[model samples]
Target: MNSSALVKHISECFIKPQYEVEEANKPVYLAPMDLVMLSVHYIQKGLLFTKPPSNSDDQISFSTPEFLESLKESLSHTLVYFYPLAGQLATQVDEARQESLVFVDCNKGPGARLVHATIDMTVSDILTPRHVPAVVQSFFDHDRAVNHDGHHMSLLTIQVTELLDGVFIGCSMNHALGDGTSYWNFWNVWSEIHMAKNRTDLVIPSSHLPIHNRWFPDGHDAPILLPFTRHDQFVSRYEAPPLAERIFHFSPESMSRLKSKANKDHQKIYTDSKRMISSFQALSALCWRSIIRAIRLPDDQVTNCRLAANNRHRLDPPLPENYFGNCINAITTTTTVSELHEHSLGWAASMLHQSVANHTNKALQDFLKRWLKSPFVYQIHQLFDSNSVMMGSSPRFDMYGNEFGLGKPVAVRSGYAHKFTGKVTSYQGYEGGGSVDLEICLPPHAMEALESDEEFMGAVSLPLTGY
Candidate 1:
């Protein structure tokens, strides 16, 4: 790759204060409560790949100074980079402190540092999967878990490693920075600008999904709030809920049968042109049951499951396709462990359909609107205190085909590492057409039980989509 062709610039930015403060007085950027949890698997495999880049040529490099300057300029224009600090006690201190962003110059340090490695390339590529696996492995080997308290932010570990065909780039981000989609949008925009490419064709404008400035439970109408100190107090009790994932490739015969059954269930005519009763929902029910049985939950125990719904279309101001950042919220529903385990596949799918519909209904939307306006939100901290599970699926995995033209991703999985409670499961399109890959992370014991369940495996005819 030509040095001149390297579109994105690299800047090793570190957050060092111009004036030092006492350790106790320093402003904490990452609050203890806001850090999203990651499963043990995610912590173990902290570094992993996203959708593969277009270039298979892996000789790693860094972005130029010009690129870094441009990215900094771009970031300065965006509100997503800034977060609101709650409480009047911290307000004055936060205002006086420097903005969280900083740039570290790695080229200097003089004298003895002459033989040091200097990576060159654009910052956008820094978010790519190339070098992440090794960086994660290094963190694992050294036993450096993310700091539970202090300045919370994402970290990129770009290194020259022989394991990743010599040059690989990896990054670990604070879940608070943004959801996966938002981060990807940021990277794609950075890449286009760095390469001096025409972004008009590739970049989606901001008008689509406007960033929300209000606190999550904004105003007097806000629906839920049980404010507390300490992150563990807020999230620790939520139990690991049940979830399942897979891609079902329907044959013509199977499709006909499904359509016929769906029509009979609805007592209405159906057309093949439009999909009916999302197949994803059907599959999820199956997977959830397997998970439930494996866990051996009590028959009457109510298990809550939710599908994270994007508000791109639902919001009064519809979020644009490329409006990047977290623009979605989840619609939660509950069912008994026994109910799920004993139900037929279709029954499971029906419940999922109704649950999602109920939550997304106009009444629900009205409730949320009123809730967001309220002074206090319902304090349902108990929801987080119990063992819970959340399963999510989106057709957005089609974005994995974003190869810059290299090829679609062979596999795509969400990165998670919540030490305490909650488990997440996701499915992404696989490299092979007509197939999708799945990844799940949970407690060590939970993972072990599922892996060993013969009955569960036999029922779904589980396919091995290796991690």
Candidate 2:
């Protein structure tokens, strides 16, 4: 279909819930981490795949109606294990304590919203590697999917869009409910249920059941889980104008070269034990340097790199494998543009490595303690600056493993509506075999500069034809 026709088809599409899916269990109080995420918007993800063929002559084909029924059934079954997803976020005031708190009202009513939509476009039409696909934005229900009012919002919304020769399953979940790990755990289990055809005998193994209990140091008093009042507001004073989104693929070989270059100069200065740097650290350093170069910032200006570090494993007496909640904290490192430009790639990489390494068990515990005392002092503005960049998510999240009976997704993208300037999200490349794809959003001029920079372009592989 042509672009205009695709737009027409998308406009003609309609969405409605297949059925009500309520929680199969009781209500649960919001954890401290959950309260911290209450004001954040939903995280959106899309999975695209070709339509599947029928398996049996008598069995119904995977048509729109049949597929919708199957997906709804599987989702309802999956919610049995993940009950909070079907619940709603409600605030309750403690009269005796004169404090207000938020919790998930698992009343087993007004379940998650699952909408069905169809468009006259193919997956190929929306796979442009350099640009954010328009269809990707059309596949989601952004306004209704997010709880901007902080009340009466469904915990999750799933939109299944039908394409000419493919399908797009878009999911939007409240960030206050859980983090990416919890989000993917729900997705993978839902896929498992769908693959099993919602059989009653099959169940998500106990090992994968989500643990809801919040973990704290022994004898430590738990703080009140209330909304942030003053400092936690998202300040937009430093917000830049709208940005352009682009995708760049890095092959394993290019990544290897970057790693080698990042460690070459540092090897002589440090002992063997401390000489090595991780792939993520090296690539982040490269990205930081490239971004600064592309933007042509003043040499004396200070630039920062903020990384979202997962604290699940970093905590002392690590949380359970299935602990499902926000366990990530941001670690920021800063250097003058002059220092960064004058130093070798190894220097930048070493700084990043040490910044992350400094977040030990004690450090993480100390952060939690501090949070308990003042949860509202943080503002989104503090996490970002006009001259700085932030990187979230990981390339190792198994994004391509979500197969809902049809097949593995041909491509997966983080939803576009939620993207912000200077934000970067990393994903395992669909080409597989450990390649990395960086989805970058920046101003138009900066994007153009990065695309034209010879050093930056050298590490980015040529776009694949089939997407």
lDDT (C-alpha, whole model) for all candidates: 0.37, 0.71
lDDT of 2 by residue, 345-435 (tens): 7888899899988989988778767767665423344546768778877887777888887777877776643456668888878766667
Q: Which predicted model would earn the best lDDT?
A: 2
lDDT of 1 by residue, 1-467 (tens): 21232212222443221222233133332211122222111122212223233345874343333333443343322212221111001111122332122111112121000011223332232233222221223222112333221123222222211122112223233333235455455444433343445432444455423342322322433112323333343222222333332222233333344434543443333233233566456445545665666567789998866666766566555545554234444566577877777656556666667776665436445755653344221122332323445564454434343332223323333322432233444444343343333344444465556667664343332332213
lDDT of 2: 0.71
**What would the TM-scores of all predictions be?**
0.55, 0.88
Show how many residue pairs clash in every candidate, following the order shown: 59, 0
RMSD after CA superposition, every candidate: 10.9, 3.9
Model 1 scores a TM of: 0.55
Cα error of candidate 1 at position 15, Å: 10
